[model samples]
Target: MKNRNVILTGAGTVIPWGAPSTDKLTDILRQDSIFINDKGEPIGEYLYSLLKTQMGKRRAYNTPNFESILHFIELLFEYKKSRYSMSSSFFRINDFFLIDPEIQNKLEIYESQKLDKRLDTSFGTKRLIANEYYYYELYLHFTFLIKKEIEKYETVEEKYHELNKSFNRFLHQVKGENGIVRFYTLNYDYLVPKISNLKFFDGYDEKTGKMNVKKIIEDDYIDCYYHLHGSFKLNFIGEKSNDYSVCYVQKNFVQNNLIPSNIITGYNKPERILNETFYEFYQKMIEDLIKANKIYIIGYSFNDMHVNAALKRALKKGSAKITVVDKCSLEDFHLKYDKIIDSNPDYDMNKLIKFPNTYQMTTEALKAKAYLNGLNDFLDNLIRSNN
Candidate 1:
């Protein structure tokens, strides 16, 4: 019997490849940003306040989330241009935008503390933002920072291979298998290709290098390799991409820009995941999850609700065996995910709590084998256990 296998890797997998952890990335973004408006006004005070913890609180007091902050910034870039509805005069966008609302009221009512401070203090910032020029600059900086970090995947040290012994063994097993194998990732880097020497189609046309998503989705026997999140290489270049373009463009050639770095980050992922080629990959993931006999998860946090929903749907069926490889102990991993799933009452994903397929990576297994700390830790435990 062929053992059909599905694998899902996350940003944690790219940590070995020199990608910054979320907290570190947050720090880098905070430390480096100029926080000055396009019109020469200093907005650093309020901008940093939004990032800081309760004005005087320590790092433990809810360290500001990089994803949430970036998402809020994206929202600010969009809703700053609020206007009276031309269609319906009674319904003003300002009603939704809170035109100069009190800071305390905003703090009490809105999750985005940065929004009102941004609107209240910085008139120049608000004006420049309303005109759409400042938004582009902010977007460019954030995207560029992310791009720089992921690009370091090429420069990662060879020593990290010590942490990858289990995966290497898994890959060797895969090499000998006649079973259907699928690989998917939530990372925005090309590390997948670097690790897996297998040739796989990723919806992009081989000759034109442009993606034909519809055609690829229609094909039945295409290699089930996909990037669940978009990648740095997958830019959509066109005049249409100008409105929210975060493309790498010359100062002179801004008009001829790619519409946003295709690498999906921050928030609003369910909607963003449907963009262009990712839609096909998303569909493929669902299909693979449903049909898979065994699933191997590497370095994923099950944090994405959209993805978790799909995974929960699959888990509810109680079929696929699961093996997770991460730096964390299985108990800690369960708690981390339990906190996420328990909080979300809308989706009952508690099925994952006792899924009965956590194959030999648990703390008990560690005790039986040896100390397995992280990806950079010794491979002795994993190698001996597998043998």
Candidate 2:
């Protein structure tokens, strides 16, 4: 028996209160304020206070840097509400040639300057991109706040706190078994590492609290975490400023050369799958999933084509049974599993599938097994005494 457990969790498993779906985030953008909860109370007061504490206790209302950041978030939220009002899914027109005429007019010179379409004239594609950037930027901001708040928990007992405890406990379990847990997150925030209290290593040394992959694999004692798309922590490129430090937060500064990491959204994700860093993490996740005896997925919507493709490949390559833990209906979950099964002609259903309810049954079986084993031992002793 492969007595090892490998868990793959999405943003839902991390964020306590927020619905872990992109549609739910769109609902927040449609709200009056991102800070206000569904009850209309400013639930974001704590977030504001934390930022204020970091920026300066004395900085007056609406300073240029402070106000600008808030304005960017507001603009993004409003834009998503306006653009995605009628559509169930957001669309990003990434085709440079299919850009809006107005944007093309402004960048006509750069458009003319490009010698070839393959020469990477991305400046012209800015207008083609959707309003989703604001939504993502706002998300990163909120996630950072959430991470800071969760870190304050010395002992968690609340329902919301359970998510953090679950992650912490799961990581420790994997470590105890001398197993490596690879986290490939779609989130731009550093919440997983912050919550797991692990180091960030992306196979290179940029001195940004990151480590090398060689050291990670050679050492059986350490767990590895990777940002599949990218992260805001890698925003400043090679700036080497410990942005997590309170001093950096107080400065409210962003470098001029800040690339802000590559955040993929909507249908443009597949294009990023080939990126050097992104591919590295994605390949490693597939490799681990194929090697695992059992895989537990929490809060991940099996929606992304690129991710689903990798998952299907991994399922076909290995004999691992999967348990999806989420609020989706059994039929909905089975529909996703069916797609994976269809990929393999000789798929064995009995050995490859399970659900959340099955997990409960397994726990019960363990208790029953213990009792039965004890009863058998007692019966043997009684028979020996009778003889």
TM-score versus the correct structure, for each prediction: 0.69, 0.50
Q: Which lDDT tens digits does candidate 1 get at residues 1-387?
A: 556678787867667656789777776566543444343333323444554534234334244555655654554544443453212223222113222345323322323223333332221221223223344445545665666767776453577565444456655565345675678888777665565546666666766766666766676444456777777665433112213323332211222222244666665676566544566788888877877777776777777887777776666665666555566665666554553232324333223222232333333321112121444332344466567
Residue by residue across 1-387, what tens digits does model 2's lDDT show?
224445666654544433234433432333324334334433233223333444464454432222233333433344345534422133222121222344334223322231222333222222122223433334444434433433343224365455555556556654455455555666555556655644645444665444355654554333556666655444223122334212111111221111122343433345444533456667677766777656666666665676777777766665665655444444554455455554454343322223332221122221111101121232233344446
lDDT of 1 at 283: 84
Model 1 residue 374 lDDT? 49
The Cα RMSD of model 1 versus the native structure comes to: 9.4
Residue 114 displacement in candidate 2 (angstroms): 30
Candidate 1 has an lDDT of 0.54
Give me the displacement of residue 243 in model 2, in angstroms.
8.2
Model 1, position 14, has a per-residue lDDT of 68
List ranges where model 1 is wrong by over 4 Å: 33-48, 51-62, 84-131, 156-166, 218-223, 237-259, 329-331, 339-372, 376-380
